[model samples]
Target: MHHARSLTALLLTVLTLLAASACASTTPGTGSVPAASEDGAFPVTMTHRFGTTTIEARPQRVVTVGFNDQDFALAVGVEPVGVREFLGYPAPDRPWAPEGVRGKQLPTVGSQDLDLEAIAKLEPDLILGINSYIDDEAYGLLSGIAPTVAQTADYPEGATPWDKQTEQTGQALGRSEQATKIIAETRAAFDAAIAEHPEFEGKRAVFLLGSSAAGFYNLGADDYRTGWLTELGFDVDAKGGEISYEKLDTLDRDVLLGEGIAEADFKRDLVQQLTVVKEGRYVGLGAFDDDFAAALGFNSPLSLPFLLDIAVPRLAAATDGDPATTPAPYLG
Candidate 1:
């Protein structure tokens, strides 16, 4: 009987040790261990406009403070502790955020009026500010909280191409290969759309936004949003200059893209006078769903796929240049 009791105690001890080992192996970023890369090497260094950030290990607690980095984070399988808040976004995640992170309770961060102290409290191991217009002072503070990455200086604000932004975000998270695949997939979709609509080639396109105060705003040629047009074989007609209400007629293009009727400064006389409008080459993007306009503004990978599927049909219709016909299939 005494010998049997000894064996039982020994078995109990082995089971306890096994449980402890399992808990110890839990991944910090996600509860489960991330899938293997080419070799499982880490401690990667990423360089940005601010400087270089060396991530000692895969970040367990990530925070994204920009328009699109959170989408990249989610796409690359890292759930961020916090994400930047966007205008008209009722929840922490944007409507177009990845399915895994949607409806999450992520804290909101970033913006000129950013709550720096709140971000600090999140205790993030990594902070991604790429695709954000983060100046030096903000960078200094965020770097103090953790290793931070910011947008490349080469691109203008809100203009980082989606592929560059995605690849950089992937590199930061040690998922470069995955990022490349995502880029290729998105590129394939764009290519397929172009293949389907050969008329989009050589078309002059412009995407414009407006507000009551700003009157009319157009993205520069450098803007990533403009890349959507270029990638689809359209020749973007961006002037890379400030377009005002007085210059409303200056939007010379075969295909005119705008957010809303009010934001596009579609004043009755102004609309009638514009050549694109008169030619029915105007695509009032808000006519489909105002959120499509917002997604274009955000310009993230998560939103890109959704935008591509819907925007292509509308664009193809407008490129026909029939004055009486609207992009009715999508407009309704």
Candidate 2:
């Protein structure tokens, strides 16, 4: 009886050890333990101009502090939890966001002002900001709440190339591959469109903002307005002088693109003084209404395709002089 009892006790001890071993093996950081695979989707660590940030998990809740940042987030297939409203722009109230993120529910976080309190309440995993919209002081505050990224270059804070900015933000979010694909796809679409209608070839074009208050604002090459136009095969004219809110009595170009200029304004005596106007070479782009300017305000990788769709057709028409006469498309 004693021998049998000893064997039983030993067997029970062995069973307990096995169970403990199994538990340890399943737990992380054990030598014999099975590791939980990241399933090829590991969180990324991103270092930007603002500071270092680690995204422990893919961000589902995001907040955009600037107009373009919001667009970039949407391009990567995620709508922001919060976004800034653009004043004096057509931001239509809708069931979802009005533009690129049209189907997603998003809250307005106020315009041109960073709503830290509102952002904190949303409990976002990530925040997107441009250098112009966010400063170092703001960055320190935002980083405490969530990982934030700022633009690489300095351009009036909110102005950066949509492609570069999108690429940077996507990398931070562990969606670099997705960003690359989006860019390539967009370029492909532009190529296809240009092939279908080749009237945008070798034509010099200028994008100007016409304001009753400020006469004209010619977009520089670095500006988003003319940058995209340059991409669409429009030769951007160079204005070497300092840019300011000034009226010009002369206009010279194969094509002239202006937003928010009334037909009556174009017909005014002031407009007739311009050489291009006298020659009938001016092609006023009435499409640059409130909605279009609002769209421009939020230029991002996601919105690039849409902008191309709108601007390219009109530009091609303006440059070629006729809808049917398709010129050779710009290859550069």
Candidate 3:
């Protein structure tokens, strides 16, 4: 009986030690681990434009306030308890990235008008706003609610590069390996497309957006959408602003792309008669869903691969210099 009691005590001690080991996480960031991320890698520290944020322990409940941050988290198996919506844009994750939000209908937090109370109600342990355009005042409020990670001051306020944004989200979640894999895959796709289309090299390309009411605007090389064209080896030097209807001729380049521009609007501005359009080098951005547009804007790991499939073929057709080929037949 005494021998049996001794075995029981030994088993209990082993179990106790195992339990203690399981919970000893929250290590400081030393960059010692590989991109796959090390177990117990937190508390991870990331410095953005606003300041530095260190996530203590792996998060259970996260809230993504950044417009496209959700997609990054979703790409690496972290779904937020709440997500920011963009003016009726279908949860970008649903179509572009379904793995993270698969069958999980996440709550809409807020857009430009952040709902601090709603976010707090979600009880998020981590608040990711890397693309949220969060100001100092807003950052204070969010950090008050939970540890908030804002966009890198490295790029324009709202325009963090997709790869860096992915890595940032990964580090915050303690899953850098998954982030590295996705980034590598996406970059490989771009490289493959570039190799296939040497003609795309050194060509001038710019993406413009316009409506009959809003006129037209240009996205320069620095813009995320235009940056994709730059990745494909286009010489994009757009100044990144409005392109008046009268000055439409200024956008004349090797390849011209636009979103929401109607054939009537082009005809009204006599843009259809431009050399770019006349030579079949102009490509309208997407189909009715504007998935292509969302992919261009989100420009996240999930969307870029999706974007490549839609963009490469249309760009190839448009840049082939065959006016007979239609880049977007549905648009016409």
Candidate with the greatest TM-score versus the true structure: 3
Query: Which portions of model 2 miss their true places by more than 4 Å?
Result: 1-42, 87-105, 154-156, 196-199, 237-250, 262-264, 273-275, 278-280, 287-289, 321-332
lDDT of 1 by residue, 1-332 (tens): 01233333344443454445445543344521255542353788887787888888876778888866777777666677777766545434456766666666677764445555556555677888886666776676667667898887777776778889888888888778888888888788887998899998888787776545445667657667677778888886555555766677777788888765573347656666888877777776774236676567666666777788778887877887566666643342
Model 2 residue 181 lDDT score: 77
TM-score of each: 0.81, 0.72, 0.84
Candidates' RMSD to native: 12.7, 16.5, 12.8
What's the residue-level lDDT of 52 in candidate 1?
Answer: 86
Candidate scoring better on TM-score of 1 and 2: 1
Model 3, 1-332: lDDT tens per residue? 01233333344443454345446553422222234445586888889877898888887778898888888987777767788886356763446676535555578776657766567566677899988876676776678667899887778877788889999888898988888989998899999999999989988886777656446778786677677888888887756887677777887888888787766786664677788888888777743347777777678888888888877888999888778886863231
lDDT order, best first, reads 3, 1, 2
The C-alpha lDDT values of all candidates are 0.69, 0.58, 0.75
Quote model 3's TM-score: 0.84
**Backbone clashes in each candidate structure, one number apiece?**
0, 3, 7
Best by the lDDT measure: 3
- Model 1: how far residue 214 lies from native, Å: 8.0
Q: Which ten residues in a row have the lowest lDDT in candidate 1?
A: 1-10
